[model samples]
Target: MNAEPTTPTTRATDEHLLSIDALAAWIGVSPHTVRKWVTRGPATGLVPRMLRINGQIRFRPDDVRVWLDTKEIQ
Candidate 1:
């Protein structure tokens, strides 16, 4: 079995809207790293569409799933 974050998994609607901190927790990385990835572009070709609310970055849960599915093989 693949140990990658991209491995197929089920998503709960409640966990869909992932903040940068939430995303980092899911991916086992630091929030800073997640922010860097969001800015520098994902290791894969998928880029998260960021929303600025009160000057804070947020990511949609569905979008993250799509991004994971579309990741390019290294």
Candidate 2:
């Protein structure tokens, strides 16, 4: 399936911010798993840079990519 393009926010265009749902889709995982990474990964170091709009969390797509790239597979 083709992916939907995200409209880059002013602060994140250069950093690649994506919604949690979008990141999960890109990584082939459930959104819950993505959230787990945010809370558990020793190296994730994710902070509040993600903007919350309408009660939903927005994450940097590049951050997600970086996290996945650096994760140690068990």
Candidate 3:
């Protein structure tokens, strides 16, 4: 009999990549908001930077941190 692995083989560092839902939760917003931000793209100048790999939107931890830092009140 053959068995399938339940867990993925991704590296721990790869976990820092944020999906729309994960980013939304981390940023205290809904997934729809994340999608909207992505849809708006850089035109609005209000969205965090993201990486597009194979057309998938993925937010890097560093980019998210920088964006948040820029938006924070001094």
Displacement of residue 59 (Cα, Å) in model 2 is 1.1
Query: Relative to the true structure, how large is the alpha-carbon lDDT of every model?
Result: 0.72, 0.65, 0.81
Task: Rank the models by TM-score, top first.
Answer: 3, 1, 2
lDDT of 1 by residue, 1-74 (tens): 97777744874466545689988887677888887777776554535666677877788877777777766587
Q: Tell me the TM-score of model 2.
A: 0.46
Model 3: lDDT equals 0.81
**What TM-score would each prediction reach against the true structure?**
0.60, 0.46, 0.71
Evaluate residue 4 in candidate 3 and report its C-alpha lDDT on the 0 to 100 scale. 75
For each candidate in turn, give its C-alpha RMSD to the true structure in angstroms: 12.4, 10.7, 8.0
Query: Top model by lDDT, which number?
Result: 3
- Per-residue lDDT of model 3, residues 1-74, tens digit only: 65976776874565467888888998898999889888988557566788888888888887788888988887
Please identify model 1 stretches exceeding 4 Å from their true place.
1-16, 41-47, 72-74
Clashes of 3: 0
